[model samples]
Target: MNITKLIMVLICSAVLAGCASSNSGAVYKRGEARQVQTVKMGTVESVRTVKLEGTKSPVGTVGGAAVGGIAGSTIGGGRGSAIATVIGAIVGGIAGSAVEEGVTRSDGLEITIKLDSGGMIAVVQEADVQFKPGDRVRLLESGGTTRVTL
Candidate 1:
């Protein structure tokens, strides 16, 4: 190959390499906000749960991919144009699904207890407990809210 053609190929390869590396190891943080509510101590009737459903739609994925593929295809034309667009759409859908999965949340439960002080303390409980429904428990209150730690 001529020196000019070799140089052009090298430049194109470097640009593509840079593009590939640009998306590597990207980290995103999602925040959760909890509201505190006060309750009086009462018998531990039942553990109540708060269900958080995933709001990501599969249509959103395919739609976003289709749009991105069209935009990508516009930049590359001819016999490879349709194929390139389809590939772009597929990649975009997978990326969108991953993002949606990261944001999806599930249900959490909080325990309610009646205190000897005649006050009710409802506490958010974590999974991994050896206690049953009728087990005697202690409530710890912080910032006007209580949690059953033990």
Candidate 2:
């Protein structure tokens, strides 16, 4: 493939892979579809804004390396080209990881809920919906995962 096309493909693949994962409370994984969840009533004690970090998967790193190696191969001839390719790959890997993280990072919320069962617990999830103290909400629990919803 041509250099530009290869670079575009690599970038697109990395981005798509990163987007495939989610921490949103409203999104459910395939395995969670048929499972039952325990529902608990609660009052929102507080809602604090939080930052959700992105995926650190190898897709970004490998894609970046491939692109960088190709670009660097065009730099010079013989041993010099090979060395440039290695350096380029290393730099590209680091940059790709950072780009992936930035692109996939999302705003989240740390919610402190006072359960009606007389227990206090906190859950952090993507801030797709607004929450404030004193709002009535429900806690859905299943397979060691908990999500707060209104």
Most accurate candidate by TM-score: 2
Q: State candidate 2's TM-score.
A: 0.91
Report the lDDT tens digits of candidate 2 across residue range 46-100. 9999999987777777777767777777788899999998988888777777777
Name the weakest run of 10 consecutive residues (lDDT summed) in model 1. 20-29
For each candidate, what TM-score against the reference?
A: 0.37, 0.91
Evaluate residue 122 in candidate 1 and report its C-alpha lDDT on the 0 to 100 scale. Answer: 62
Compute the lDDT for candidate 1.
0.50
- Clash pairs, candidate 2, are none
* Candidate 2 stretches greater than 4 Å from native: 1-19
